[model samples]
Target: CLSSQHTEGNVGTKSEEKLIELIPLIISCSREKHIWKHIYVFLTPGLKWHSAGVVRPTLTVLPPSKEEDKQSSATVVCLATGGFPSNWKLGWTVGGTSTSSGVSTSLEVLGTDGRYSWSSTLSLSADQWRKAGSVSCEASLSGQSPVTQTLDPDHCSE
Candidate 1:
């Protein structure tokens, strides 16, 4: 028992019966008002619709925790947040050389605002971290230019 109404407005609402049925579920949540506000905002017109697909992400390099052992390795994490489409490539390079060892990437997490966040980590030995040249993390998607963040390995000195 479902029905959809087509209006000139940019947003639409579910049938009254469906909303009544959803009341119980909404009441159990703390964000009921917030959810309803979004519904209302969606149903009304006169608002500009911005496409999230072209939104560029903000990139960050999380500071790595220091390791006391010279033989031990440290993890460098790069995070890209607030992007759309949920498909992005993350690659690691050390001194202009592509290195795939000790790398881990997480699946993109979709946010409530329709954007996404992704993260990748690379492990580097203490010697490599202290003596290596440039380390870069690149994030890319089809049809869009890639975004890169570079870090100096020498800056990781203990």
Candidate 2:
């Protein structure tokens, strides 16, 4: 596997060496700042701040217990957290086929860390849960790739 490293450099510098690295950025920001503002004015209407980082969501699947399955059905909750912009989509799929029936989705909640969290529940029949197939939960954001978590029905035990 290939890995990468990131280094943070101080933007406010008093030394000439540090200043040399920032000269190009400083000059460009001075001239193009106005242009960028004009270009993004409509895009960021009434926005005070914007998050630059694209935080991928963390997904968790809560399988139903055996007792709960006795009612001929199971309830599985998919939790998605630590995402940004509060505009995410959560979905459920069984064996790669999407399902909307018997699904309830919650609204996005903002956390103290400025990220967002959301959850969705899928209600499946006990037979569906016992089919030994895969159930997947997917989370996605506009202009970004989707993140998914899967659970095997065969692995769910009493």
Candidate 3:
């Protein structure tokens, strides 16, 4: 069963009191066969609100690994961190064109501070990387502007 409660309090030294609702989320996990356990969780205060209070994610674009630079192909990674909720999506673009082939995205990882982090990787051939003008990583959420980070291949060091 799910229960909700409405509460009001002052947040961050503001004189006005904010109204927040507490919604219980129940998760079930099984440690062994036929053995099931349930855990009840509640979101932090600021996260209890709707999209108006959504936390934007910080994006970082990492250059190609040194080991991969020695090979025929190269890989770049994009990491998005400190976003609220787990519904954000990560996408990649190479030279201003959206590229999905040889791309991999990881599942959202929930942090103890009530935020989420995710990562995406893009793989390209050595020849392609050299000529590729710019690579971008964008994190998108519904009803919000996407956060994008761009990296120039020419600026990257071996």
| TM per prediction | 0.65, 0.68, 0.69
lDDT per residue as tens, model 3, 100-143:
99999999886646678999999999878878899999999887
lDDT of 1 at 114: 53
Clashing pairs in 2: none
Which residue pairs show collisions in model 1?
none
| Tens digits of per-residue lDDT for model 2, 39-106 | 01001222222223457889999998888788898888999998865778999998789988889999
lDDT of 1 at 82: 86
* Model 1 poorest 10 in a row by lDDT: 20-29
Backbone clash total, candidate 3? 0
RMSD to the hidden true structure, all candidates: 12.0, 11.7, 11.8
Residue range 41-99, candidate 1, lDDT tens digits: 12112223233325668888764676433447767899999875567778898888988
> How close to the true structure is residue 134 of candidate 3, measured as C-alpha lDDT?
94
Best by TM-score: 3
In terms of lDDT, model 1 sits at: 0.64
